[model samples]
Target: MTITRRFPATLLALTLATPWSAWADRVYSDAQLHYVNFVQETDGMDALFRAMDEGNIHDVAIMGLGVAKKWEESAPKAPRYYMGDEAPVYYYSATDALLADAILERPAAQQARLHPFIAGFNPTDMNAVNHIRLMLDMHPGLWKGIGEILTRHDDLTALTKGETARANHPALMKVYELAAAENLPVILHSNITSKRERAPIYLEELVEAVGKNPDTTFIWAHAGTSAEIHRYQERVSGLHDIVSTLLAEHDNLYIDLSWTVLEPYLLDEGEPDEEWVALVKAYPGRFMIGSDLVGRFDSLASTIRSFDAFLNALPEDVADGVARTNMLALLPE
Candidate 1:
């Protein structure tokens, strides 16, 4: 399992190893479409899981749970839909919900479906819920009268941010250690509702808190795609940490351009920013290619086309990383 010194440098080796067609002058063909999925909602969770089990999708991350839930809950007479989706869940449904649904699912019933494992809960919500749960001395899905836990699965998120339940804190270091132990990469969905809210408290503090745990991976989702052409150009142009954290974090850390892929913003050279390409050149391997806010498998091609338009507009060195290799590095081979 030892990685050899054949790599001249971490960055350079990554650039060379990527496929050549990705760097061609014209846009990459619709065929590379094979590697991408435009996941919009969670309605087709069972079908997708079946697809994955059947090897129909091997390249995508289990990242888009909102899409699934929304589609399912909104769909006509959707069989297994959860009622009135209103949880501050982290990424997808929690590990417990997923297991519970599967074990209870009837072979032909929709009750068997589930979103992604990580619930992508807001850090604020995560902190808040942990606080309330501590006060109630309860876990998710606690019954009112019987005090029963709904699922049989053990709660991995049993640790608190600090010694006390109500302490204003982050479990950054703990997240790092657990990710390392479990060999699961970490994804932080920053670039939230506003650009200015992107600050010391959320992930940078979390990153500083975790410091360095070599095995852990941290991804800053969205990469401020909302920072349109002007803000990126005239105002907050020098924000390398936006780009740097993507580069400087642990080996498994990554950035996935989900919401950002749809942005119409641009610079004079028709680039998002020169730094995006430069960042890719700087750290190609530490990225995971994704396009969020999509609908169905049929709808993915359109999303891919949009993602390609943004990618093709970028300098070859940068777009290649975001489009491919960065995520491939994490394939659990």
Candidate 2:
């Protein structure tokens, strides 16, 4: 559900008080549109609570993997390496920096509304350079208020060298290190793409790195993807030799059903019920439910319905694990 379209925003970097506060702003044109008011809408963490009440699924805790205010721009361009291009504004600058500034500058409730739940960020679309550049180029036209903010702020380019190899690797490691220190479960993104040739292999190396860190509890995205399965067999003959922390790497790691394109393209559409049930059971405490919800691109109902469909396919015990048990184990009491 990684919609490749976007509206532009301020590209100025702010001198952040904390690294996470590097820069922050509203993701949507109308602040009310974003899913920030989960509690206001339904009383608690809205979706999880609803799922529990309806018996659609429950017991799992949710941690959003990526949270950016909006696309730097959407001109249908993609990064050559999916991981290389983060939303443009995440770069660096000082003058116009807000969110951190705004959080400090504004009231507490207003700031809390801006922060997203999860620590790590993932942009699953491919064709990074143009996909990102086109949007940046278009910023002036679409979101001028943000453009004004950028005008007043400093513009910073990527300090990380070799964005694909070293840059992404380092950023990921930094986040993992923080999460591990907090003893929080780390959802190492397994965001996969069939069309991108070497994307999966490069990403696999990073996942292996996280697996090597014992303090970090890793969750693989998309069940390691078909490419991961094929490559592990064809290339390494399934050794996974790059150093890992978890003893049962495959079983200990988790992957959510979100981040996939279509039902059939993923696993089995016809007998998905049995297949998903078996797969969830096979993972044990490791697997947890994730939506990778692309609200700007898709309808919330459709996204939830898809989760519902996956739940319907699972055996009751397996569904219970995915919907509740696995998530509960990952999150703190």
Candidate 3:
């Protein structure tokens, strides 16, 4: 049976109240987003499409939540979010089916602009690659990419009720092999380091994965940053240097300028960072923008537009690519 929980009232209100036309005057493209939350719930595709049209988002790379936040008995009430309490979250393998069904239910016109990715398996399980293979076989033309795979996510990692996931996990390497064979790009959420770490301690794992999977396209989500990392103000020191070096070394690796990566790295207090600008200019094809919104469509436009300052800082062509075309280019024909 499919399980679901009610979205928090405050979040629902905020999502619905934000005017879609808030950015009607400016259209932006998103490279990473989720149509469902941790509990596998959304406001339906109708609302999402309306938001997309009104928000002027012409294309998007969307996926389902890989982990489902469980409402444990000890947590007096149900948790509305992944971090709502000490409740444990687990891999929801059925999420890929749900995502595929939702997209198949949509009209072809609507589906055209929506690039769906497979993301509902345990990355550490040896059988995880089997699940991915099965999903691909089950829905041959539906899946455009792989992942949003959770790895080394600080709070989520601690709360997750299973083996720890890492980019360099044996199972994930196999999955990468399959992705390369299938010509599907992979989006991975492996943090560069833990919150308190001063250096990019976990960088080697990601580097190893990217290095080994030369043929598999890997889009490092948030450029290896996360909300909790940003919230605690414990972002890895020398992140810019780390990212620059990775881009310089990895030809198959790409970075998404998601909401979490926008501040500090790409922009500081709404001002563009010259270092990041130089990096993007140096490798314009490897960068793209995303809202990182999960199950909330109202803020999609504003969140994507948040990158406007950094995008504006780039040359016109480079800005256009980061704002739109670059992500589309990643979709395999």
Candidate 4:
């Protein structure tokens, strides 16, 4: 049976307002946190550490944005965001190095808290596998995982100005093979369906990726949901059924409870959803929390604290596992 409760607004507000790191009560390890923005700029190491301190986040699965939103010559004004202009977004390969450099700049203790994952490669490119190998060789011990590998993203797919990346792409297969060989976890973002499609058009592709590579630990980002997807359809009716079925079948698969998956699924109107609480409690080790905050520090505490309501509803041990240990357990020793 699933336990349910509405999180007290006053308690939540107080938790968000206070800094927990100093109290040594830092209870979270963000399973997914972006270190850089679309343009490859970060909140700076100092600011990031400060935010981490404030949020009581002990560790992070940090990575850079895979695609860079370009400023086209035709556009007179500079676009601040990816959606700000009509300029095409392209694969930015240097992102891995930028992330590596930032981590390297920090003190050894601070550096250990940031687990760098490589993004910034085109999943459709055949050479992408080689790039992954190269990053591992170059950094030696820095990389913990591979991805936010973009595949069948909503507007980003059309704006990407190249071949669409499907989860079952041959190039990505090789990448998965490499990750398996390296014993690294992969975080892939492949939308289950397009914005307007009622049926899950792209579900097969993701299933294919997971089924074919049983050795690879794959974290399906947001359980195949996106902000735009929810905007078009309030919810994917079959999401719960689909996820339960997949988890039962695939032991290597994990679901990332990023920002997108929180609403209309995990939490119902700010209270913990009983069904989702049951789903998570059923597979305690497979569900992990993530902020998915990109290049921002101000909201890190609030963003992570958002998971509290849902986490608090689960058994204490299960709640602790999802919030702290699950993602870190996936990383290399």
For candidate 4, the clash count comes to 0
Off by over 4 Å in 4: 1-26
Off by over 4 Å in 2: 1-162, 165-168, 192-194, 198-200, 224-247, 250-252, 259-262, 265-267, 273-276, 296-298
Q: Give candidate 3's whole-model lDDT.
A: 0.84
Count of clashes, each model: 14, 21, 0, 0
Cα lDDT tens digits for candidate 3, 89-150: 99998888888888888766677778889999999999999998899788777788998888
Give the C-alpha lDDT of model 2: 0.34
For all predicted structures, in order, the TM-scores are: 0.51, 0.47, 0.91, 0.92
> In candidate 3, how many Å is residue 44 off?
1.5
- In the range 1-333, model 4's lDDT, one tens digit per residue, is 111111245753453344333345648989998888887777788888899889888889999989999998899987767888888899998999888887887667677788888897899999999999999988887888999899988888989978999999999999999999999999999999999997999999999999999999999999999999999999887899899999999999999999999998999999999889999989988999999988888899899999998988987778777887788778875
Native-vs-model 1 lDDT? 0.37
Candidate 2, residues 137-178, lDDT tens digits: the string is 432221111100000010111212223322135445554455
Stretches of candidate 3 above 4 Å error? 1-26
Q: Can you write out model 1's per-residue Cα lDDT over 61-153, one digit (the tens) per residue? A: 433231122234444553222222332122232332333343234242222121122332223233423422332242222211110001111
Worst 10 residues of 1 by lDDT: 145-154
Candidate closest to the true structure, highest lDDT? 4
